[model samples]
Target: MPDQQRHVAILGAGIAGLSAAYYINEELGPAAHVTLLEAAPQCGGWCQTMPQQGNSWFECGPRSFRAANGLETLRLVHLVGLQHSILLADRRMAMARFVFLQGKLMKMGPVSAIRQIGVWNLLRETFVPRRSHSEDDESVYAFAERRFGTGLATLLSAMLTGIFAGDAKLLSVRAVFPLLTELEDTYGCVLLGALCKMVAQAAKAVAARLTGPRRRSLAVAEQWAKEMKRKSLVISALPAYVLADILQASTLHTGANGMDPQAIMVQCVNTLRAIPFSSVAVVGFGLQAEQCPWPRSQMGFGYLIPPSEGQEILGTLMESCTFPDAQPSNVTRVTCMIGKAEHLQGSEAHLVAVAQKALERHLGLCITTGQSAVGVAVETLWTAVVVQRRCIPQYTTGHTKRVAQLQELLHLNAPQLSLAGQSYSGVGVNDAIRVSRELVQLLKKNWA
Candidate 1:
């Protein structure tokens, strides 16, 4: 019999969706029919970088992609010959991060974190077992507390809170910080695993210098080339409830449609719907440099606000300092975030006001109450707000098991379906593009 026609339907138009569609057409060849579906009229989903008045730019979604783990997005850009369009932040921003702890913006420099969480305690824990039982998955809080005690755990919580914007007590260590868990599992201790890897890598480097590079066979060379050729594309908006309805309909086949139930699609959709999401608000304020409360010397990178500090805002980014083109020299462009922004009801203005109040409470030195009023601390100059409701997925407890089950369900029931998003894997833009590229290659090899 003739081979069944292959048609791939991609839901959403965010970075992952676009990347998948692009790869299906580019890598899989034109034989496959690929339909890119996006509920939003525009593409790029949350990876939007818009222009502020004048020549400056403001990112509505993710501002910067880290240049770690192969820097796939940068390679993708270079491959597309759009190198000039790519942007890089200041070196200081890339190297250092700050956290707002104990009512101060504590610079997370090379030696600074020791002041907050002692290195001696962390060192002592490293010699001990990371977990009594590695089989059971643990929350980020539980996992960190077990390995490094409460002080280190608190700091880790704040750091991760800056990353996921999810409550540390709820996030799964195996899901969110997979590397840390991998270290513990492989070496029976977290630090030992890391140390061994470093030593092994150094030894390998010396051996490679002695033995020289190994030549690859034709097939191996071709495979390596294919993997190296990075690509891009994305999905936009489609509410979870709407997606769930479609999945349910596809599963039951109880409606007017005579089609059989798509069991795989049902399971895949159900698994996706199970992941919890958090709402985040990014409030951008452009102000004169003198009007800012943070000292010029201390502003290498923006500061993250720990939830334990009882602050209303989650974190603040120094857009102007990091991305110089984000604002004019005379103006300082700073953006503050409000995690769980959905819980509060009001307009964007209200969210901005809350963030401003928090900012004043933390950074300002008032004459009377120590809290500067709105428009006084940050000096809001025609602010813009981007509210992402149910944006970042929270990989809560039992997430590792949930993901394993999800993989099995997709592989067996819905072989044609693929999931790539902040919900399943890493939330960065690099992850979206890299995962899609790898998945497309796999699909191509298995297309027969």
Candidate 2:
């Protein structure tokens, strides 16, 4: 630890890496020299926004975020001065969701969703006995099936397919939905834990109303100032496999820490490589508003197809319904997501046709394959197909344990290096920003 400035090399320029760089600069100011390195020519990674003519745009990646859990994302948005461009989905529009079960689209309102999962089965979850203590991690589906029965587990699997584009049978409940696991661990029942949390949150809200808002004192700043010593730092926000490749090719130093750096690297690299990923193809379609056959009653956030349906596409998002300003008033936008890494072998046109066929089957739309409004009622304004290979990290069973091991190895062998991004803890814009801020604060506190 010295008074001199330190160099902070941040790998990747994705949302997580960008957030890390921004936070470090804001926290350390002139005390650290931040360098952002990206393998791609452009930043933002999977958060790609493609522009179309007529002042419209297509979100080839994640279209909208859950506002309730996106406090960090909102803070970042305000910091970057894009607050004015923000659009909120209508409350009703956001709630109306559908699932392509059987042959037709079934609207999943609160009651219908519960009925689909069986209300008796859900009620029985609280009475279900908790499992005995075990070190091994379980799949999301297994955890659900154990507590809530097969109905709930099946629904969870379908829901997870939409979120992670991954098989819920393979996804780790501890890594993917830690809150669910934590609830079960703490209360022996997820429902009981949720009810307790709600009551506690309500109590806190009432207390806050009477006491007014809490004030931040200068003690935090004083502590940070005292710990603001200089130290070299390398924050990696790259994919786990990519980072493993980089580390495997690089040299390391064993210091006086007495840990075997070579052994640590080998284990770390193996763990990183073991973290699997899922690819997806996002097919965006823009159609004339007048020509669109989707009814107003059916208008809402688009539908998700469960694996039981044996469909080629994962789901579709009604972009125009969610974000009205994203397209012109005359244009209706929708995006189809095709999951599975192996399904992305054909050309972009072939992918577009596949998406179109799915839409035709589910939505009963008259559309041609890879053609724009040729003898079709739905006048196609434009179409875009983006195939993202190995994009979403699949936190499979034992993912949490593997990550813990990787962190321990890095802490012992390479104290200067740290990992962040969707590959590690959480996977979302909000999670990225939140972890980046947290990592920066931790680095500031332990800079020496």
Candidate 3:
């Protein structure tokens, strides 16, 4: 590694690439020159934000990211001097989550959600010792069901809906929720592991006080181990505490896939392809104030429809309510999403009509009920359909090992090149930023 000017060409001008470029420009100063390339002409990747004549803003991709993911991206946002653009969802709606069950949308408040999913089930997960796979990985459903009950395991499907647009049964617990896997692996039980780890940390701190500098290195090693054991998905929108064990499990390991090296690498890639990616169809609608109605249960950011309920659209975001400044005072922008990739293959007009019908059905709105507004014309609907084909990555079973193998292969075959984005690591905005940060650091070592 040299401390001189270097030209870095980054593929995919998404958030990850852009974040890398930004960090290099600011951190490395003129020592690094970044050329970000994307197959598409535009940047921002799936975090697209479109604004029109009024204050109304429409997003074909993600509207907002979870604040808990990390401060890296938020710091980047401020570094670029875009802090004023930030918008927070209404407090009442922010924590509210909903799922379709028992023939209607049920608010997943603590009482109802605990009753529906059973708190004892989670307790079982916390207390019970679950089996581990030394060679293979487990699906999200299987992993959760073994520790937690089937109810909470299946409920994880709703959370995955907003992410992979795929099924939780198919998602890899080790990949998507690696923190849980590591916890289970370390102590045989996640909760017990956490309790022991905390106790051990306290004991180590006391030892450091007695041993001084000699024990400092041991403490540092232990701290690194603790960090290695905890990697979050960065964009955790749900209650992160509930998913306390789910964290990053990225580490270099071999022989986990199988004994055969070449066959395992091939199988690893095949597994990557085998992991299904769902196409999301988003309808961004600009509605008059009278069109959008705020329901009591729909007070939160938005609601997610579980696969059990079986609906065309995944969920609806109360855009106006969530980001009040994104819309005009006289208008409320509603965002409706259909996780099915092929749904938007139909005519745009047909898609708009279908979305309107869905909004009416799910949210109980009169906007499109005949949409039946007195003087509002049907043409004023101003609906736009965004079909994102395979934008999200599905972390199927064995994903962590597969990713580790892929990294190994890259190191062996293409040492100079690296992969970064939602596909390789976590699929949140902050995840991308963190990946980019790591990438820049690596490049500094390689090209500085």
Candidate 4:
């Protein structure tokens, strides 16, 4: 093959796009010309950080992520030279979260720990699993209730509602929790499947240790460097619908749609309109170290409030406890989230009031109108981060056939393009990273 320079245009500057640029440039080197473009002025779409007063910081999107997914994120952090800045949660101090059941906050405790163990219920949940007759028709709520019983389902529904700001009954189980579905299919019960999976994972870890670090798609530093070089990519790391529009506008020709590509693209984009994201105002209140309500010595992550409580704000995070250096000396940072998508039409003042009430209810802490009493209070912080992702893309009955059709259309019509993102697989930072990496490889093999 000739050493022809491959010019790749990346559409968005989000994590996925940035990661793609890095991979293409670093792995492909001078053989590829990578350009990264953003619709917004800045990079880090949702992963943005802003300075707060007196050694405090605020994250517009994700503050911290668990390292459970593997070393991809850790590698990125180290490659970005943020290793020293990485703050690990104090595991011992980290308390189990609670649900706002009925009207009170109930701490999450194992049945044994809570001293309310139902042996029959536990046995059924552990051994018996519900089987779905249809391939792609079960909702998240139905699946959960079937597998874990009503109590666990209710508890999880509350938590997931807060996470996705979505209706549990409408969300697809396959799209939202593919692993869970797989476990049920393979082992009949989630608990049994998990036990088996854990044993296999342990064996794999041992094998990996013996084998040493395997070659990844691309190193983090290389990816970063490539991202810096690209002006933009034609397609993006955004949802398929979003990319479809861009592709239609671009010079790229899709034979399937023929002369009416733009119209077809619009139809595609409109086919699965994103679930309206709720505007959330995250208010952080800082109190003097002496006035902090929770244990000062015992550092740990904060708690969440379930919907059953009829609370305004979703949850609060104990910033000082969750991350070291999150707050200054003699100051405690409490983060509160208000105005979820479900309540987007609610007034800002109403949201704030609800947040205040929730804070009081959960932590026995009050937010007073005193500058001296409150070190900092960020009101109505603007963040475009959508709360309700059209999670569980409507994979109705015969959804597999539909996806297969779409795949066929893409191959036959738009060979230069590939669909990727949270919608295709799962929604998580790690999942997005994995998909983007795979897409990059696909692009290289086909277009490069």
Cα lDDT of all candidates, in order?
0.65, 0.77, 0.63, 0.56
lDDT of 1 by residue, 310-384 (tens): 777788777777776545666777778788655345688788777767656655623223234333443344567
User: 189 in model 1: Cα distance from truth in Å?
Assistant: 1.7
Worst 10 residues of 2 by lDDT: 212-221
Ranking by lDDT: 2, 1, 3, 4
Arrange candidates, best TM-score first: 2, 1, 3, 4
Kindly indicate the candidate among 3 and 4 with the higher lDDT: 3
Off by over 4 Å in 1: 1-5, 201-243, 252-270, 289-293, 341-343, 365-379
Considering only N, C-alpha and C atoms within 3 Å, which residue pairs clash in candidate 1? 12-235, 13-234, 13-235, 13-236, 14-234, 14-235, 14-236, 18-233, 18-234, 19-233
- Model 4 residue runs over 4 Å out of place are 1-3, 109-118, 126-129, 196-233, 239-241, 244-267, 272-279, 295-299, 339-343, 346-350, 369-408, 444-448
Clashes of each: 10, 0, 9, 16
Off by over 4 Å in 3: 1-4, 126-129, 132-135, 195-275, 290-292, 370-381, 446-448
User: Measured by TM-score, how close is model 1 to the native structure?
Assistant: 0.82
lDDT of 3: 0.63
TM-score, every prediction: 0.82, 0.89, 0.79, 0.77
> C-alpha displacement of 418 in model 1, angstroms?
1.5
Tens-place lDDT digits, model 4, residues 1-448: 2346656777677777777777776567777777777887898766677776656666656576777754566776777688998777756545545566666555666752223224555667776645855645576777777766566556656666545555566666655665676667767788777787788777853553333211121222123223333222344567555665655565534456354665545544544233233345666655554444543432346655545556777667677666555565556666776645555555556555666667766655556432222343333222122232332233333333344445444444444444444444444566566656766665555444
Best by lDDT: 2
Native-referenced Cα lDDT, model 1: 0.65
Alpha carbon deviation, residue 30, candidate 2 (Å)? 1.0
At residue 16, candidate 1 shows an lDDT of 79
